[model samples]
Target: MILRCNTGGTRTDNFAFFIYAFSSLFAIVSPVGGVITFVSLTSDMSLDEKNYLASKSVILACIIALFFAVTGQIILNFFGVSIDSLRVAGGILLFVVAFDMILAKVSRESVTEKEIDISMERSDIWIFPIALPLLTGPGTITTIIVLMGSAVSVLQRGEVIAAILLTFLITGVLFHFSRRIYKFLGYTGMLVFTRLMGLLLAAMAVNFITIGIWNIYLSFQ
Candidate 1:
């Protein structure tokens, strides 16, 4: 059976799927990223320092995304790593987050276990954990790089950036309504939803691990 490949349709479909997957992942992990940003900004930083740091972090996120877009494969190559392995690791992380969300245990260790020092309690909390890791942490950063590499066209940059911006905007609203959302959703609601997302994230992790191992095996053959 000679079936003609729908290159155009395939690319479009893939793009859409990638966008949603990435966006959902971002949304799921955003609360943590936001928290990180808020903490970093408000801790031991002046208003001007917070602003500068936030801007720097934002720029760094974009730069990291661009680097991954252009050299993600190269990065793997350099580290003798495979996308599958990366996926597996990422997937595991995602799954943990999802489980936490489902269970409603939204702790910092759900993502990174590093202890944060909130010494400068007088600083602007908005820019610290709120924007950085809470919004653009390792998971978010890795996802951006992977998606950037998946683009079928240079023009898709706009779409990808748009997707990121959209996610960020939504995240902003969530943060803006943090008190209210927490009040309404409550910990139980958050946990229920988080657990659901964890299952989805587990699927993603399996894919990464399977594909990564497969690729490694294939290379040997």
Candidate 2:
């Protein structure tokens, strides 16, 4: 009975971890944004070409996310930045992103109009704006780093990595079906969804800030 209880507790903790990781990454990545960008960029391409681009972009994003997850702590250490400081800074950045999302803006902080215009001139977009700023932008990178920093054990790190992989997989699938999703959601539905996600992200940003501040306080005491 004790063993069973312990196992159940572990399962619950893992579930909670996964949910937080998934939701935070999802809000930051904003697959709906990916759908819009993918559809527009691939409007002139064939279905096969669209599928190929989507796959490549998603795979690239997954690689980038994992790279950050592994190296984030090292990078922070090199920079002499504490995880709590990163959390505070990242929280501020995320809050700004959430504000843009709430306003139904395309998040110029992630992808600016100039970048999109330049991308239009390029033939291969899978590596450019699509994979970089579109799918795995600064916001997403910071979120992953923060989450990785918070991970206390190998198992927890693995769970965070798994969540990143799963989120990008879902993102790729959504991009592959971008046209269908756009038609189903329409512009208004998409705006509503973005706003709702923004609200959630804003709340998360507050939580991050609070935790960061509390940690900083504890360190001094």
User: Which residue pairs collide, candidate 2?
Assistant: none
Count of steric clashes across candidates, in order: 31, 0
TM-score of each: 0.64, 0.94
Candidate 2 on 82-113: residue-level lDDT in tens?
A: 99998999899899999999998888767876
lDDT of each: 0.54, 0.87
lDDT of 1 by residue, 29-138 (tens): 55433433344334455546654655554454445445555677688789987565676576566656555554555445322334234524534333344434555566
Model 1, position 176, has a per-residue lDDT of 48
List residue ranges in candidate 1 displaced over 4 A: 1-15, 31-80, 107-124, 155-158
